[model samples]
Target: MPTTAFSAHYSRELDVEQLGWLLSGDRPGDDQATVADLSQWAGWIRTDIRCSSCGKTGAQVVRPSKARGSQAVLRQAHFRFVDHQGGDGHHPFCEFYGNDTGEARQTDSLLNFGSEKSAETRAVRLLVCKGIETGLFNQATIRAMRQWFFDMKSESRFKVRATPEALAWARSLQRHPSYRRWTFHPAQAEMPAFDWQAAAKFQFTEENLALVELAKTVVHQDAEWKRAGLMAAKHFGQEVFNTAALQPYYEDTLTLCAFVAKNSGISFGKTSPDYYRFQGAPIPLLALCALMLFTSEWEMNTAIAKFARLLASAEPSDLSLGNMIGLNPFHDYAAWRLVILAAEVAERSLKGFDYQAQLTAIESDLRRQHAIWKSAG
Candidate 1:
């Protein structure tokens, strides 16, 4: 499928289903998270991620982007959305200006970013910096790194965060040893900054882990995922089936992202996996379900129904964790996809990663930027 079509479908799915879920407040208490808390949580997730990519154990990534200026808010995002439109006319979902086609003037708010820190940019910047620091990463590598971090944190949506220095630091880390693990490729000559103990300090708990498991399974199932494909059969499949590979990766690195984030307690980005899934409640259960359905290769239909029943049992009379699988606006599939790729890189560089899917999502999201869209066209 073309990128536009995939995004259109994703948007349509969210507009119709996910929107109702968000508005209806139908998710399990597990997904319940306050944006107020998300900042600090995101900081922690970054800390763990920092350790993994930068090889820095003694000095955790400093969260310098916490206090932001007023002009850096989401107002400019409005213009970005406008630019995304490219005057190509709005899709069926757009209704903000009360019109679909015809050029719309940029609103004052459109010229600004929301006071909210861009979690997506800041978080991804940390990962992106890993790219820059490690050797000369190509633009595609940068894209992959950025896309991966965003997916790991947001699942698939975008997160906004931190300040200018936050972005700069993220750039710096990529240059360190961490960015080399962008996709679990062949072999990395770069040594990690932290020893094993430090790696264990930070980790992803809650929903972040839940989503990582899902994304891992996704990477496993995808034939396009070269190294992971081999590893998946050996680890995700046989290990789960016979050898028991699921928890090792999570224990050593993924969970480290969480533990590190929790201990570091920095607030530079939007929604770090640390912040959102800081605890071990709702996200874990969701992850368990995802594993059963996606990885175990068990009865998927039964798994879907099981999760559906779990969602049904939750409050609001109607909600399912599955609904947000790839559509949550707060960084859904796209972010987690990166996490999966990064995990692969942690062990070794892989010629695998589903970037095409991610690019499609980003291109579509860019359209939502409006301003970027107009400029692109």
Candidate 2:
């Protein structure tokens, strides 16, 4: 008996009969395996499939017996290679086989169980500003921060008072000794400049708890990743993304990106005036602006003013968020991290935001710009 490495690529769970048609000697017409077709098979138990890697035919889907009482065991679709007397020969060097070959097989083990690799080993190295560690800010903090900023930007009048909830959270944070040295005056006309030195010195206090702590050292090297990359894409398994893990790394930057994307009416799709005002320009550049406004360490008024300036001058490109995720600089952990943050921002913005008011403001601003241009002419 040989064991086969499970591949997530075959998303469809094939019954004995359907699988027979696929593995049949007679060529079948027009239907190739697709992720969409197999997507429904995600939680279903599959059986009687062939292993594409080992050329092992009639591999039975293995699952454990159902549990009793309130304790339910999750059953997964997998395969164990069994050779019937007349069946096709199994690959002599099946990676999934349990036998110890008595050789230095670190490479083989990693290749076989790559997806099962723990985050401790696979944790991505990030260039977080020195003071920040994991759990510095949580989702609740981000929502309040973004909402406060949004209110500051949207309200027309001077010094609109903060809600008790907003003021309370802010006051509580300031009382913490780690943040006491840093000035946080949201009412100030200018954004507080980021003090990288102060930011760099932050250490965890008993009051604040982080979800995912920063890794001690880099374990899986890029060289190891390059080697692992050579394996077929199917073995990589589904990327287990924990957005909470990114919260400590990103802080408020994530929420800000989301606010810009949602309020600016920029999303991932082909450009149009209805969805994105600039029909042919780079949408991501505006998103980049949103992230940068917060990054610039400016206060509420200055950050809002900077974004207004961007809307007036920035041009659209053929690029989108989906497009940016595939390109360099934007690609990698930052893009995924932003995806989580942006989604969270967008969701919150939809429920509580005054989109109609924002739209009216934009239209009025556009009219003002037109008048200015005409006067100049």
Tell me, by lDDT, which candidate is best. 2
* Per-residue lDDT of model 2, residues 142-245, tens digit only: 22333333343234222112232322222223233442333322222123563423322232222121210111111122333333233313222333223234
User: Which tens-of-lDDT digit does each residue in 25-120 have in candidate 1?
Assistant: 553353332222123333332232211111121111111122345333332111111222233222211212222122222211111122342333
User: For each predicted model, how many residue pairs clash, with residues at least 3 apart or on different chains?
Assistant: 96, 11
TM-score of 2: 0.19
lDDT of each: 0.27, 0.30
Model 1's number of clashes is 96
| lDDT, residue 337, candidate 2 | 30
The window of 10 residues in a row where model 1 has the poorest summed lDDT is 1-10
Quote the lDDT for 295 in model 2: 41
